[model samples]
Target: MSTPTSDVHATSPAAEYLAFTLGQEEYGIDIQKVSEIRSYETPTRIANAPEFVKGVVNLRGIIVPIVDMRIKFKLGTPSYDQFTVVIILNIGHRVVGMVVDRVSDVTTLLPEQIKPAPEIGSAMNTDHIVGLGTLDERMLILVDIDKLMSSAEMGLIDAVAA
Candidate 1:
């Protein structure tokens, strides 16, 4: 006869996130959404575009809109240096690029390691914030890249199509 055993230590499957920095805060996006990471390059400016929407760059034959995450987040004046990079993302059927200070590393988090985003007051919009992931002493602000890139305020998808 065999005895039954408990699996109390079992954890939910892990999800991977590509970690990057904007200003002083560390943020993460679903690894699957990241198409590629490229070095920073000055993109051609578009008139009447929002300050955050840096401009567009040609990737092969594709015109990709680039947004500076620092400006979009109101993280104060951004300084583009050697560490800056553009994280090309594939959102839905569109491809967009977001400029970040620097990328850290891809982190894997178990379901238990992620906590729901706190409900803050209405002064700030937290719709894009998916959750907070904790690993060791590091905390990652997980963002819903799809929601963010498709939001009307960015006008990224519509602008690209037009």
Candidate 2:
């Protein structure tokens, strides 16, 4: 008889996720896309940008745009503190940065551990939600950072780099 591992490997592979929080909701993104994590530092504000766009930062010569997930997700106003950190993500062609409440340890989840998220209508943008990752007692909202940043609304960059 074929083992479950054989089937799982054929369909999908285990992947690492970098977990973080925005208000009360815990979220994660693919670890492969994460370039680095830096302490929260105030960025230079830009003119005529969305409220969520906290402006851009100079990271090793590259001007990276910073997005506050709390503000973008409407997860209450984020109080910037020492614990806050910017997750440097290499999504698409743009190396963007996101300000998360705090950084949780990187966790690896098998394909079976990710479950489909229930439809919640337009109240929440589901386009970026890859699935709900259940690891033991904790559940993480898996986010497709690629899609989130590429969406016309985010305006940072494009998906499927040309």
Candidate 3:
């Protein structure tokens, strides 16, 4: 029988991310960056920000900016509903919320199952995708959240700090 250590060593850290459905495709992000998951809540809008920036919301006592992943990825505008979820991400030392279609369970995949993002045939920009995790018959698009929500893209977070 193979020991757990051997099993763990066989896979890469990318396997630890939580995979979820965005639009019609699957996407994954490292679980370490995820703070909490909540249902969609209307956020207070800020003026003069990028079109994709959803706005800021009061999560408990902390104010967090929310970005619609659909718009950020150029996947098209998203409509908020009960099914939508706010995925709170701690990227670049700032806590921001992102609206996703839904939340899926966390699962692990072997390193061999993950392939670098393909150059073509993707609906949205492939720059943010770190790799593709093939599990069974499904594929999870692994995302680099730090790159997606860089400090430059979320200036408001810094502005509020000053």
Candidate 4:
């Protein structure tokens, strides 16, 4: 299990997120869904896979697919650095990797700190977002990894980029 750092802040039920950054924004997913976080390492290419799919990496004994969340989210490519990380997440019994800029903390938030994704005129797609959590000085984008890892969408991304 990953240890929580002193900068981590938790409030209540929603406070169970593992927060990370991609570019300038901060995002979070439920900690229960995460298996591990490792340094951003190059993965072996899988033929016929999507461009956004960074191919596969061996985790323990299992081969897992890795996704560059920057490309998936329409953000430009992120430069790999010492701080870059591949966060392993288990969604619907399948393990996958998400490349992020850097991990920040394990944070907690109260129910009131979270709000439903706005439906109208939003610049970003809200489909994968469960809600937005607010801290006194910052906010975290709460993601529904299952939705983000939807097989149909994965197939589409793969088919198009292959």
Q: Pick the candidate with the highest lDDT.
A: 1
Over 16-45, each residue of candidate 4 has an lDDT whose tens digit, in order, gives 899999999999899989999999889988
Candidate 3 TM-score, true structure as reference: 0.83
Clashing residue pairs found in predicted model 1: none
RMSD of each: 4.5, 3.7, 4.5, 7.9
- Per-model tally of clashing residue pairs: 0, 0, 0, 4
Error of 2 at 18 (Å): 0.4
Model 3 Cα lDDT, one tens digit per residue, 93-149 = 688888899888897877777787888865556677788988899899999988777
Order of quality (TM-score): 1, 2, 4, 3
Candidates' C-alpha lDDT: 0.88, 0.85, 0.80, 0.82
Model 4, residue 78: distance off in Å is 1.9
Candidate 4 has its poorest 10 consecutive residues by lDDT at 5-14
* Tens-digit per-residue lDDT, 32-135, candidate 2: 99999999999988776678888888888888888898988888878999999999998766788899999988999988898988899998779889999999
Off by over 4 Å in 3: 1-14, 121-125, 160-162
Task: Using TM-score, give the best candidate's number.
Answer: 1
- Among residues 3 or more apart in sequence or in different chains, the pairs in candidate 2 whose N, CA or C atoms overlap within 3 Å are none
By TM-score, the better pick of 2 and 3 is: 2
Candidate 1, 11-67: lDDT as tens digits: 346899999999889999999999999999999988777788888899999888888
**Sequence-dependent TM-score of model 2:** 0.88
Q: Could you tell me the lDDT of residue 129 within candidate 3? A: 77
Query: In candidate 4, which residue pairs get closer than 3 Å at backbone N, Cα or C atoms, i.e. clash?
Result: 10-108, 11-108, 15-108, 15-109
